[model samples]
Target: MTQPSSEKINDNTSFQAFVPAVSRWLAWQCEMISEVKIGTVFLRSNTANNNLKMFASWPENVSDSIEGKLYDLAQDVIDGKNNIMPKMTCDAGQGDMVYDTTTLPLHYNNKVVGAVIFLQSVRSEDQKKAVFQLFQWGCALLESTLTDMYEEQHKFHPLVTDLAKLALQDAPVALIGHQICNLLAQQLGCKRVVLGTMQGLQVHTLALSNQLRFDTRASHISEMEAVMEEALDQDQAILYPKSEEMFSSVTQKHQTLSADNEDASLLTIPFSNAENAIGAILLLRPRNNPFTKEEVKAVQYATQLLGSSFSLKLRDEYSFLNLLVQSFKKKTQPVFGTGHL
Candidate 1:
């Protein structure tokens, strides 16, 4: 069967001119390194219902693993909680070979619109970094493309509305904090998300998703505190692609993303209400893709929604109205196991 005309044609008239731009970036990257194949570019679309659909990929040689676990990973990236770098190994007619997969989360406004996935059949360490850098460049190109797409389509309200909602409760401020962390995990497509609380000048680990199950005791809160301080100073979302490498010098047990490792990325979203940053919401992903600006905005909006809900709870009693909001918070939190809240 003939593929859809929209498949991989990156023409000016094509719905996605982003592909050619990405190809140009990849080509430039390949020039920098000899062993790089400009792999296919995959687009994950979010229709009017907020449901995600993976569009056909470029090159056609790169097969999509977006069926089971990979599909879930894509969802996480769309929800804004993914940090895992997906692998690109496939049977190359001749035999099975290793291919490095690099992915970048795509967004329009503050919502995750889709992603661009690249597969490079190179193993050299330097080549891998060059390919990774190309992915980051693709992200930038995709961002510009999205701005054009949004202008042409001019529909963004439904996109933001499709973002998952959280349940809020007047159980306790700590409970709200815990649930917010989980929501960040769910939205960001990370394996685990943790919340750290500030007590005086010291920050304490408050909550984490069950999937991660990291020992707060194992980490020094000072490290997290330092990260948050940096985020606050920057006044923006911070991405920690190689936590282990950056924080390794600081003597903290940091997590790193490897080609073999399933989890791909680590994210820290500073959780400051109208007042101050009570703590931060962390996210995890196993696919090798950095969070997109749209994904970041979705996360920031979700945190703002949670903060608003928390503020409402602080003002009123646990009446039916409050319970309604709290239930939304519960949907995002993992209150079933760790009975801390």
Candidate 2:
């Protein structure tokens, strides 16, 4: 395996350009071909920096660990220096752990946008061939999805593009949270935006675009946070207009929030990843500007796109060196406590 490089990775926000075919949180499909734990890494291309940043990874651990050798080989495939397609890139072992890897470059419009890497535990030539064939099919499926996403990027709204920039920026999480809320309030024409995530049973406010410092004791802030908690507790987006559509048990807090804060259209949507709800956003719009179904759908879709982008940016900001220090973690833990990328 190649040693880690000092190359600056591109913080490509292109993920927002493409609406994923299926929510990654829903169908985070990672398949195994035989005993081989194949990993397909989609790197962000078409950015200023050529160095690849992971888009999605299979076997999950591959997303966190720096697969220098695999990435380097994939880079070679993209550079046209290694034209041989679907070849075993590396066969190595460390202690009892063996990693037999192969690289296949994914090209679009005659340009290599990303690469697929298949890694198996067995070092046998016969097994490597099987993994290659299986990975080829996987590549076909992935490439189709990427092509659709690439096409969708060109049609995305200006706000979507701006959201991409916010996601890619090398900024602190709190700053990013502020930017997201500010952008939502500005472009979406909401009265205000409250962004936060749950801490224990209570919601922890991250950013209030209009208010620099969160007033935890404020009655309105506490009520909005309660509405956020209601949505998170139910694991779904809660729109004040659609309160009647929800279970009666779920409707009480939403009803109370709306009653207390009359006129403003309140909506809270959960920000989730592959596992569970990580955070929520409460958008307050003017009384006259009632939300349309189209608007609701757009908001849901935007959050879906954002959840993955935010997760990647967050991990990018996390210390890979810290992970290296943590005994070469195979599976990434929920990385919090930060440093700059």
Candidate 3:
């Protein structure tokens, strides 16, 4: 399985995203097969009131008894130092049912924050063994999913939050553009990034990474202008699978950077509100790998948020400026300011 990119960690944030990701995965797994009638993940945490809350479910049913049952099972697993459980019986809706089980703890900074209980119905010995193996795999999957979700959230959350805050301010357009470019370069899963804008008849590179260069050479400059304009005119994102080949004739200093310092694949993600193209985000990924669908989707959502915020701020500033002008006009009127005459 493809693991999450290494970025950073936020334990609570990771757990938040992890819980939902695991639940969705369980749902998907059940849909993919037959005979697996039910599945669930149960969690327990001490809330602010010092009461232990049960956040548990079995596919469609979110039962109230899950907290106590899971707390008991969790203690058993921790005390025995075992990773797997089988033939556990628990009350469900006032009746007894044998539940095949596997439990994993949510790790936070190498400490267990909570326990994950994976459950399904038990039938035969062979069936139980197969189910156990599947649950083990699920544990590994959950670990990877949680780690990635946390890292991604950690890396982008600040940027998005900052953008939302900044969008309320009245600032010069050039300044806002520069700040956005800087954040994208530092946060996005890429070595280099560029911010581009379209003028009346020319496309301009608003910002580029400090390490990269752009060819001022006649041939490539025209080509770069053409590529940028196409992206703006079409209002679509562009992904260059082989960025070096795409701009093969251009110099290395101007291309995207990879871990080994090689030229990287490039992605030009367009950002616009309801009006038109505001700008495009240029990102560089590893030479052979490109942005995944999920990453792209995330960036798209961020862009929309940024665009909407920018639009609102601009409208407010313009209104303020108009008010100031009207006030000045009134103050300069003959009756108000020409008192000496």
- Tens-place lDDT per residue, model 2, 124-177, is 554344335434544554454545453443333455546645644556777878
Of 2 and 3, the candidate ahead on lDDT is 2
| Candidate with the larger lDDT of 1 and 2 | 2
- Sort the predicted structures by TM-score, highest score first: 2, 3, 1
- Report the C-alpha displacement of residue 99, candidate 3, in angstroms: 59
Which tens-of-lDDT digit does each residue in 25-134 have in candidate 1?
Answer: 34433433334443333344333334444443333334444333335555666666656655645553436666566656775544455655554566555435433543
Candidate 3 has its poorest 10 consecutive residues by lDDT at 44-53
Per-residue lDDT of 4 in model 3: 39
Error of 2 at 59 (Å): 27
How many pairs in model 2 have backbone atoms within 3 A of each other, for residues 3 or more apart or on separate chains, i.e. clashes? 0
Number of clashes recorded per candidate: 34, 0, 0
Model 3 local distance difference test score: 0.53
lDDT of 2: 0.60
TM-score of every candidate? 0.36, 0.51, 0.38
Error of 3 at 257 (Å): 12
